[model samples]
Target chain A: MQIQQLSVFVENKPGRLAEITEVLAAANIDIRAISVADTSDFGILRVIVDKPKEAIETLKEHGMTVSLTNVIAVGVSDHPGEFSRAVRLLADTGFDMEYMYAFISRDKGRAYVIIRTNNGQKAAETLQENGFDILSPETIYNM
Target chain B: MERYYQPEVECASREQILAWQNERLVKQVRHVWDNVPYYRKKMEEKGLTPQDIQGVNDLKKLPFLTKDDLREAYPYGLLARPLADCVRIQSTSGTTGRRVVAFYTQHDIDLWEDCCARAIVAAGGTREDVCHVCYGYGLFTGGPGLNGGSHKVGCLTLPMSSGNTERQIQFLIDLEATILCCTPSYAAYLAESIHERGLRDKIKLKAGIFGAEAWTEEMRQNIQEKLGIKAYDIYGLTETSGPGVSFECSAQTGMHINEDHFIAEIIDPETGEVLPDGEKGELVFTSITKEAFPLLRYRTRDICVLNREPCPCGRTHVKMSKPMGRSDDMLVIKGVNVFPSQIETVLLNLGMDPNYQMIVERKNNLDTLEVQVEVNETLFSDTVRNLEKIEKTIAGALQSVLGIGAKVTLMEPKSIQRSEGKAKRVIDKRNLF
Candidate 1:
């Protein structure tokens, strides 16, 4: 129950995001969810695309430093206090989350949150054990 | 290995050396006063004449010559000899304003080569030894000085002027070059390259004479272990003829100045007050024998102490410690001189803010220059690809200006530390012992 995410090292400059998206669009690789972690000098653009391998290869060919990271995608109820419970469960189980971003699924009345943890497998197992729906690569990529 | 190059001179008595200096200095002062009108004005403004300078002790009475004086004098103002009489010119790598050119007569060239020959001999060089000179030729003094010295010593001289590491190593192995002459940094680079190629045992180098820039004892040890050779430090400047002003003997304590031709002095850089021996201060050199571009009481701006202690190598010449620091902000990167003002000028001309930091480090035995510049909001908001392009543009501009490549890192505005009094511009992390 892990999804492959593309992490790109990007210098903090104008039109860089557009260029990356342009490359992905040109390659017909659909980005499902995207978030950027920024520092003063540079940024790490984390992207979940439909074809992770293709996206990585295309970006690498353009001389970009891209890495494939395994992250757990958790399906949570799109309601108040529901996301907090899942976060609390992970916290109680000593699963330290590096970063996380959420996007609601259009078909179902549920929200899917992508989380990068220190240990992805252990976090996925812990979430599943606590009766939360853990997303598989196929499900996340398809969504 | 034999120590002194000219025994009567290198191991000359203090009284004898002083007498030679007194006579030569008096003659040189008079020569400059009669020939160089620019220096004559400086002496005239101070209400002094050549007659006022009787000996080395009266050197302080003479007007001090600095880099500014050299710049103001420019091409011909400081030439103490007729243009037709001078044979050559060696210049400082002018990364800043104007290049300071020092003319050399045929006799001057002979003396300069003789000084370099003394350096080689002091480093155990002989006629049987093949001297490989990799210092850049042309206007730069390092290569020509050593090449001529190698010929003077009867060494089969290899005039491989800088760069082309593979070819240099191939020649080193094929020719069995025993004495290597180049900048200390280049020596380190060659040593690293040789080790990386696994050609340690195939080489036959026994000693290296490194100069043209500042190096530490730690760097010396590091290069020595890698190259399996004793690295000797040499000291010189274009103003005082090239490498051979002073040289380190087998004792390796400090470089002994060629007192027969040049007189070394220590002075408080602020007040110009002469300091006694063993006191660390600004080094001053008075060329008693230079003819074409003779300078009196030329301020070197190098901070070091002079020792009059008898050397184990039997050279009675006064020894000067390796330059501890510079009184100015001049930096030597990869043996090329760089000033922070030069970098600032490049940045401002490009419409960028002058807030920047230069980081110098020795990686893989080669000096790496990284320029971290603060990016404006517009640049920071640009695409990563565009930002990278800008970085490359800035790097290219710096390279064109500096004559050396620098890695340009675009940083956020206000990220660099700002100071109220003096801005901390350079961070040199090369641990020098």
Candidate 2:
């Protein structure tokens, strides 16, 4: 299963992140999980939110560069080897990953890692066949 | 004490100067009509012969020449003299466009050197002075122009072209060069280098004759203060003899246009109507004296004003103020003429969206260009590396097309401002005006 992640273009400036967060707060959009890939000049803000469609609209209205990217969310047991095993499976299968960020669930011994790979469909299938729970968009949005 | 290279002409009265212009204009008109078929055809279509253009007053009756005309008659189409008589050629820095090349005979070079000599003498040059010329040699005219002028003035000329700052400073200090000639930006860079090496006091530069690029009055003041010299502005283009047509005197009001050799006019850019003296408009020049590549009523596309106000320097020549703006969409980046259309061609050829903005800035006395393109769905990617790769690809393409590197910035969609259904193409932060 693939979930829609909001990717934002962020120029390196003071209070830019704060401005984006303030916009999300005003629109009552709760950011479920977020990861920032940064360089000295600029940064890319990848976010999973409660309402993907509304978040994209609000950010676009605020003049923010926002795009929807398809990323697979894999649920794994909250253990050190569990996270490594899923990535090792993808690596062994020669599936390249752009980036990945994790968020722990409320339930004990459980976590979801967002994986952005070259082929989302094939990677999700590979992870699903390898004894991993492929989390759906609705399940992640309600988390 | 005040000095002039040629007192007879530089200090000539209005009547004598008018007499010279009247005679030269008539002769030059006939010379062009007889030799340059390209311009002669235009004159024939207008149903005019050389006799109709009797003096400077009838100058406007002739058709105007622009860069397009120069390009059309490139290499030898507009040569009034035979190739055997031609001695050299100088060119403008135009990349991806037809390079404007001007031919010169021995006589033309002599007169051009005289113009430059007048500039040097006006800047307090003397035979005892060591003229350190760093204005770039080769086809570009700045170095050779000043080198010839310094020699005519009898100053010990150093033909050191631009760059190699360490050696430039060494020569400046050891030889104690009195006159420094280069672009205003290079002059500023030299000042910084001298200070950074803690050798400011060792520099004996008394005056700097800077040209070939646009600069602000504040930049002049800064360079003057740092180098401990008076910075004078010299104006010229390759189409018209190069870097010596006009020069600033100690009077510091404006540059006196060597009015005896060239006639300067201000015309409304849109209507082509001649504007009165002291009015700002596009500058036009008609070379009455250039033998090989004489341009008649050539439109310079530079926005400036001509002033006949009496100067304290005692030169009777009319002075032209510094060019304030351009009549068209051309940007002078690091002394290179960059047209927005040229940039557009590169982007379109590379399958990029036509919407882009050119940002010109002056950082550390150097010109920097940044091209900002709006991101479309096809251009953007979720991965930063891929997006950055696109930027690098565009930058490389621009470098090869423009012969200069530019920073490529990918802006968001619908971000570039549009006016009247057209995007504002250029945002110049140089503040040259």
Candidate 3:
């Protein structure tokens, strides 16, 4: 199964992230990994948490605008050529990455890149068929 | 703003307004009988003429010119003057079919601007203030009308039009604009933008006179809090005169019609029976002093109540409650009449943000309604079960208020698409045509 991500829309103001974090803390939803994609008007607080559905619900209950997205987390050899080769695989497969970011694995020798493509199911099938390592919810949770 | 048009014949008392309206009503009746053949014929059919009308009290005797009349006349049949004599024309595009257009002479434009100037004054605008007109320009009548009024008031004006958020902010900072003129929806957008940009400290805007669309009190408070300004409501239509027919005075309870220039009447929309003041009904306006396109008792179809109580602002003009949903804005879904304002009232009563979207669709010949509400961060929790419960609660609220079941979809804050002009609240996909 694809990993569910939470994209929380927050006004670009100070302590907004802290406020969101406090709500999650109280809810006991552990944030696995989070990154912020910001624009001038507002910022998208993209979060990968242990419990995506629960996190989304809690955030919604707190009056936050959040959406759940299915993304493929690709495990790659922590090398420059490997990353380039994986991107080429996506390009050759006709799948465009809407957004992506790298997260370090616990071993530190291997790296994981979380990718959100326009078509998640097709991209997942294509990447799987191409022998590329597309992550599962269990793999991401363990990492 | 108030200084812009201290009526050339300012009547400070209610008695004066009645006297002025009575005189104008007599003259307008006679003028309609003489010039406008359509009004003359209609009045003659009703066994009424200039001789049958006495004064303002006799206004009820005149038959109202409904929008159907405007449509029947089409382009120029309503004009009381020659085409060459008319200086301006304003129109509102209807979602149903052809746009409604009204013409005006130079004197008419001046009088309209004077009414706008009265609005500016009522909102505490001054000659030294800077007015930023954000209402749409061109055929929309709001921008240019407010622009003319600001100039007449001697306020340094920024005719910014609408939707250049960055440039509008820049002007507000550089020019220290004190008054804002725009639709309430756009004002909310600007306020949201200013808050996001953290420019609230730099923006000098103190008062906003918003119109051209219907808005709720919750929206008013939200805009007020975000912009640090007192938000005022103005009511008008291109069919009458733009932006200045009635405006919220300092009291902020209701809008005071420039009763001296226009006669206001409440009439039962169904039976065409004129209702007494203080009763809720369709508002009708008769342009008393207008020369070119003086509408004799035009039915505006704006539903609101009238109050003749004296305002603290020392004006005796009859005040109108901010017009509720337009007669045309009413949505007939599954044979049930619904107004978006009713949903707004429910949302506000629930302590939820008024930002909502109504999706209407037809499936298997049955109407389906979905209301997507943005989750307020203050009320959300990080749990799946709780979010579903909140969604159900919202659905329950919707069902109770609307008397029709709606599938409630919880949306992320700022995710429903903020509108800068008219808030797109409905998506009617019934294909009923």
Candidate 4:
């Protein structure tokens, strides 16, 4: 299962992140998870949103440089060793992770991690085979 | 005291100048018809002959020659005189296409020198003064042209050419050179050097004859103030003989065209219709007295106005205003016309927003063009390598339209500024005029 992620090009300047958030807020798009890959010049803002397709349109309308990426989400038991287990599963299979970020789920004793690996479909299959929950795009977006 | 090299001809009456032009235009047309077959064929295409063009009024019927015509002819197509009879050749510092090589006979040199002499005298040069000629020599016409003019005016001339700034200042002081000749930029450079050495008191430059590049009135005043001399502007092209075609006299309103040697006309660049005096248009020159290479109705591409307004300098030659700008906004980058509107068309055709910035830089003495377009979804990809591929596609598309490769950079949206009106599309760091 593949999840939709929005990657925005953000210039390194004051209040740029705030401007992006304001645009999503005005369009009633809630950001579910966010990570910033930053350099001295600019940053790549990867975000998971409640409504990704709508968030993309609204952010683009506000003249933001944004693109889509297909990533896989895997759920693990909300414990210290559970976070390590999911990444070690992909690592042992030699599936390189391009980028990965995690967030706690509201459901009791569970957590979700978004991973952009070299192969999204294959990585999802590998995680599911390893007794981890491969979350679908609908489940991730509705989270 | 005001002095003129040839007072009688320089201050001739309107009728006298008109008669001279009519006779010369008639003779020059016949000369081109009988000798320059390239131009003869053009005249034949128009169903015209030497007998058809009687005076300057009939001059419009002849087809205009452009830089393309000169390049098409290449090294020898436009020569009117045989190589044996031609004594020398001078060329433009052409950054585009084939360099224009103009052949000159001994007599042609004399007349050209005489034109330069008029400019020197207009700048208050005299036999008692030592004139410094710093314009580059060899192929380029500036140094040689002014050097010959200074000699003709009987000024003890120093053919310094350009560069070697310390030596230039040395000669300026030791020789007490009264007249300076070079490009305005080089003049400013010399002034800066002179100031750094703190030898302004030792220098004795009275007037400067600066040309071969466009300059501002403010630059003129600045150089004049720095060097403690009255600076004058001169204009000419190798195609019409160098830096004495027109010169700003002491009157300083505009430059007086040497109408006796060349016929100048301002015409609509697009329609080729000649505009009346005082209307801004493309300047076209017809070399009437040139014996070795007589070009008729040659387009100069410099947009300026001609006025017959009486000059207090008493030189009756019609004056031309300083060049305003080019007739078109096309930029010659690496010898190709890069029009911004054409880039817009290319981007529009590719189904993308044309909001972009064009950067011109000079590297290794060569011009480079770079286009940075704002990234849109259509051109963006998650992978950095894929984004580079998208940039290559834009560069390839621009090359297809511009005939020259441009470095393309993908910028974030809204990275380029867009004012309320007339967005600046180019950032030129070349320092070219």
Which predicted model would earn the best DockQ? 4
For model 3, what is the alpha-carbon lDDT of residue B142?
89
Q: Fnat of candidate 4, please?
A: 0.55
Q: What is the DockQ score of candidate 2, to 2 decimals?
A: 0.36
Supply the TM-score for candidate 1: 0.77
On lDDT, the candidate that comes out on top is 2
Best first by DockQ, ranked: 4, 2, 3, 1
Q: What's chain A's TM-score in each predicted model?
A: 0.97, 0.97, 0.92, 0.95
Best-first order by lDDT? 2, 1, 4, 3
Candidate 1 residue spans exceeding 4 A from truth: A1-41, A44-143, B1-3, B96-98, B378-381
Off by over 4 Å in 4: A1-21, A32-54, A57-65, A69-143, B5-16, B67-77, B82-110, B126-144, B147-179, B185-204, B268-281, B330-433
lDDT of 2 at B216: 86
Encode model 3's per-residue lDDT on B70-161: one tens digit a residue: 87887787878889999889876342224568899999999999888888877888889999998878887888899998888889989898
Q: Fraction of true contacts kept, per model?
A: 0.03, 0.24, 0.24, 0.55
Q: Which RMSD values do the candidates have, in order?
A: 12.8, 2.7, 13.3, 6.8
Interface RMSD of 2: 2.3
Ranking by TM-score: 2, 1, 4, 3
In order, candidate lDDTs are 0.87, 0.91, 0.79, 0.86
Worst 10 residues of 1 chain B by lDDT: B377-386
Model 4 per-residue lDDT tens digits across residues B182-245: 8777788788778878888998999999877666687788799889999999989899888899
How many clashing residue pairs are found in candidate 3? Answer: 23
Docking class of 3: incorrect
